[model samples]
Target: MSTKTVAGNYFEDFTIGQEIVHATPRTVTEGDIALYTALYGSRFAATSAATFAESMGLERMPVDSLLAFHLVFGKTVPDISLNAVANLGYAGGVFGVPLYPGDTVTTTSTVIGLKENSNGRSGVVYVRSVGTNQKGEMVLDYIRWVMVNKGNLDAPAPEIVIPDLPGAVAAEDLKVPYDLAGRDYDTVLAGSPYLWDDYEVGERIDHVDGMTIEEAEHMLATRLYQNTAKVHFNQHAQAQAKIGRRLIYGGHIISLARALTFNGLANGQSIAAINAGAHANPTFAGDTVYAWSEVLERIELPGRTDIGALRLRTVATKDLPCADFPYRGEDGKYLPQVVLDLDYTVLIPRR
Candidate 1:
């Protein structure tokens, strides 16, 4: 009897070029940092110690990049992915200024691409979102696409418009903070002696650690980000579907893989950009996650000898060790044990 109740946007409800400003600006806090460290076991020195960060020319310890990413991504869930089937992939992601505690973040998204599925029950929606701090400075930006269910099967298909996106952020375009230069870093406090020049291209490092996922840990991590996706929380609903259990958020696996890398890559101080990423398979509670990394490329910043960038491919697997590099089958299909395949860049001190 009332048309007031609001359901989230469905596939058929979207129009290309529409702009949606998400609600609820969130303020970063020390509590968020503590909870994130507890959940992911991240040990990046720049984000873990204010004194160490200040020694490297930062004003204070910055929030973990993935933490900032999850927060901004959470803001778009209700307006963009609430009725989604799955988050498909990501591309052309770039981080701007470092986020510190007490800074507030807000987001806006624009629909950039759309394609109807042949099955007629679902379609893909692509959106580019920009997250900005209270000072109106952009903190992060990225393009993500999701598969969303249709609210009306009979609705006529909208004109398809797929945006042409970059495969990677250009090396020259990466912004290294001005204060993060000068090579005055402390190796002892940073937790590793490896520097930019120490890593050779084509080298692979198995992180040699595994952490079994617990139901409560993932639930708490997802809730802390304010992510309200039902597939991550509703077990009864998921029990009726394929997989038969709640799916662990892919970002959770990303953070776990990043944390495990501290064993070998602790000196790789900060994330520069995310070139591409894919959640190859779903993860569930009780799966033991392991990680491995391959150095793809190395770039020297034009004017700065203080730091350089390493292009890395970090792979996460469940119940499988990465000693032999378990990636895909001969036919190019991901193995059942493989859960994440991420390609990104990180900045490390130069010797």
Candidate 2:
């Protein structure tokens, strides 16, 4: 037998402090921006119009933050999560600089924690990954943990190590582009008149729109990111599993929810940071995704009167409308219809 074929890494394969430089550096382009917009219908003015972005002091429209996130995340899949059963959660994610079309992105990850499941059939691997541009400027940094399947059920468990992670990124550390400060923003062109001052803490906005997920669209988006997780593909193999269907990548749901928020939050132009996120439930093709957002906190940036930040909790529900803000049960368990619960910071114009 040829020894060239390689099986992907499992729980037993990772060690504390191992560094992995991911493959396939990707250069963002106009084509990716167009395709992503078509896939999710994202309409933030800063990402959609060059003229609008220039009005806000950017030379050109930058790619959507989520698109940059997906591209960087895709590079880590082949090396980190090829055999993952599930991606658990993310924390302390920060975007350093806006990624322009011509910028090339590469990624590296460090294994920071590990824990064997009581069943001994699986384990969780925690890694902190950083994506940097060609100039070696860090574009994004975050910590994520995944549940990976074990190739050998009888393999001895690794030492349990769980790194201490912050529950959220502090407001003072949120990064805003240098050019974006002190610029007069246009709400009329931005689509929504609601500004940072308009949103009050504890206010909820039902996006009042839904998008049906198509198998082809999800698969294309996944491939565009170059994410090769088997559960997201290989329907025949998935049919034999518990869910019995290919899983939609959680990032897909996040982008969809973020896009849907445009109806009520169009003026919230840039994603300053991702505090935390979770895929509470799995979503499959044909499910109509709905979203709603609650304002968690309002922040004022020192010396900048043109912009402010809103800590928003955006939730995605599959086949469930957000009119009632569907979420966890009284027992603190996610309802079956809830697919995503994302907490992130958005920088919006100050009226």
Candidate 3:
């Protein structure tokens, strides 16, 4: 719980096989679901109306895949990117399993490669992080790269090794929740703006509003991820486990954080690139989710910047007006209300 600042630096600081353990585990809840549905306008039947999900063969719609990825990644920030200069890219990502409403999420990383910038001021570090549930089953995995500052040229160079990763997941790897098969579309109630084609790069959007999550809300999300590690669902679990009440789902925080980023970042609709990101601490229910963003880097691909890449940060909390907010409690640990800290790259339209 020390409040010391972290010193991060250039590629020279990273070894090909070092592992980073992020601090704090999170629980998921129902509030996370309601906010996700309200903010993103995603109408996957399983996620929204519960009745629809039951028909699809699920106990309930599981958290979205991107949401799950964000939660796991968010936990790695303070330990990994406090000094990051830029996010580079993503690869070899996979969704390992379904997440439920009351589960705890934890993450770990293995360094893959380190490439020093010819200029020596900065370099890129590639890493693969995996997210796991309470039972220790893999929930999500992905590869990412980041630009880091080189504080000193004298820093020793470490061995560089890259990992082999798959592009998209095979259908079999996808764990469709119980009872979820065919979807029930709610065209009238669902507010979809762009359908793959409607997006153009450089366009920014505001997600509009925020919502507060309750303890129960987060518990539900953790359970949905099938992250049954007790700390997320039972108070008794915390007494014996040393964790507090059922933790909030890292994915719930991710979704809420991403939704909060709608303002100023709405134009970057597609997630063309995932340079790198992390969840700084555990977020619980009763935290209000809020967000804002910046356009960090862009690229022109073939005939288009039509879809551009944007580096962004999305933070969540237990109350309103989280813009320019502060994290950390007097004890030096995360505040009870603060939920998340995230950074990533998204695709935007440039038409």
Best by TM-score: 2
Q: Give the true-structure RMSD of model 3.
A: 12.3
| lDDT of residue 56 for candidate 3 | 42
lDDT of each: 0.89, 0.91, 0.56
| Model 3 worst lDDT run, 10 consecutive residues | 172-181
Tell me the alpha-carbon RMSD of every candidate: 1.5, 1.3, 12.3
lDDT, candidate 2, 94-134, per-residue tens:
98889999999999999999999999999999999999999
- Using all chains and alpha carbons, the TM-scores for the candidates as numbered come to 0.96, 0.97, 0.51
Candidate structures ordered by TM-score, highest first: 2, 1, 3
lDDT of residue 277 for candidate 2: 91
Model 3, residue 307: distance off in Å is 29
Per-residue lDDT of model 3, residues 1-351, tens digit only: 785955543456677778988778878777766655654444343445666545545576667556667678767655555445534455556556577779788999988777777776777788888999999988877787766666687776555455564543332333323321244433233234332244344333335467676776565555433443333455774666455555555556666666555443433433433434445555556666665444443444343322334444445565656555556667876565555545455543333
Candidate 1: regions farther than 4 A off: 1-3, 178-183, 240-243
Question: How do these models rank on lDDT, best leading?
Answer: 2, 1, 3
lDDT of 1 at 44: 92
